[model samples]
Target: MSAPYVLVLYYSRHGATAEMARQIARGVEQAGLEARLRTVPAVSAECETVAPAIPEHGAIYATLDDLKHCSGLALGSPTRFGNMAAPLKYFLDGTSGLWLTGELVGKPAGVFTSTSSLHGGQETTLLSMLLPLLHHGMLLLGLPYSQNALLETRGGGTPYGPSHHAGADGKRALDEHEISLCRALGQRLAETAKRLENNRG
Candidate 1:
C-alpha cells in the first residue's frame, strides 16, 4: 500500500496563497508524511469555458479521489468577499460521494487564506473552508499557542488558520510569522492524522 500523505490543496490568484501551500507542504513532509500539492482551475463566467484536464504549469488538478484518500488535508484559497474562492468551492461541491461514504471521517484538516487587505476576511475565509470539512466528518485542526508565531504575526496568522496580507498592490509576502504558522499548521495536522490512524489501526 502507498504511504500516508497529506493533501495540500489550494487556489491562488496573485500567487500568495499558492506559496503558502508550498510552505505547508514542506512542514507536512517534515512531519514524515508525503504532501500532495494540487490546484483547481479558474472559473470562467461563460458556460463554454473549460480548463485543460492537466495543468500546463504547476500542480495537476485534484480529483475527488484525491480528497477521499488523503490522510490529512491543508486547504487554502485566496479570499473572495470573505469566503473561499469560486474554484475551490466548486471543486468541493463535487465531493458528495465522499461525504456520504464518510471516507474522510476522523481525518485531520486545516485551512489557510490570503487577502489583498489586512482586514479582508482572512479568518472568515478559513472558516468558510472548514465548514465543508466538518460536514465530511473530518477533525479540524488549528494553530495553538505552542506555536509562538501565531501570537507574533503582524500580517496574518489566526487561530482559525494561517493567513496572508498581500497588501492592496499584492506586494506583501508571507512574513516570518505567517510562514511559521503555515508550517506549524501542516505539522500539527499531520501529527493529529498520524495519531488517529494509529488508533484505528
Candidate 2:
C-alpha cells in the first residue's frame, strides 16, 4: 500500500488560500505523515477549457485519482460570494466515480478557505466544500475547541476548519493564531487517519 498521505488540495486565485494549504501541509507533516499539496486548473470566463497543466509556480495539478486515494483531505479555496471558488467546485463535480464506488467512505476530511474580508463567508465556503465529501461518505473532521487558537483568532480560524484572511489587497499574511489552527487541524486529521487505519486493520 502507498504510505499514508494527506492530500491538501486548494484553489487560490490571489495566493491567500495557497498559503493556507502550505500551513495545513506543515501541520500534516508535523504529525508524522506526508502532505501532498495539489491545486486545480483555473476555469476562465471565456470557456469551459481547463487552464494549462503546468502552473507558473507552486504545486502541480491534482487529479480525481488523488482525491480518491488520499488517506485524509484538507481542502482550501478562496471565497466566492460565501462559497468555494468555481474551479474547485468544477473539479469536484467530476468525482462522481469515486462517490459511486465509495472509494472515500470513512476517510477523514476537512475544509478551509481564505476570504478578502472579515465577513467574507468563511464558514459558508467551508460548508460548501464539505457537501461533496459528505456525498462520498468521508468522515468530516473539524478543529475542536480544544485548540485554543479557535477561540483566540480574530482573523480566520473556525470550527469548520483552518482559515485565513487575505485582506482587501489580497496580501495579508497568515497570523500566528491562523498558523496554529491550521497545524491543529492537520494534526487532528492525521491522528484521525491513523486511528481509522488501525481500526480497519
Question: Each prediction's TM-score against the native?
Answer: 0.96, 0.97
lDDT of 1 by residue, 1-201 (tens): 567899999988878999999999999988988899999988876852267777888788898888878899999999999999988988898899998889999899999999999999988899999999999998899888888987787899999999999999887888999999989988998888788878878
lDDT of all predictions: 0.90, 0.90
Stretches off by above 4 angstroms in model 1 are none
Taking the tens digit of each residue's C-alpha lDDT, what string does model 2 give over 10-93? 998988888889988999899988999999999977796467869989999899888877899998899999999999988899
Tell me the spans in candidate 2 whose CA falls farther than 4 Å from its real position: none
Give the true-structure RMSD of model 2. Answer: 1.0
Best by lDDT: 2
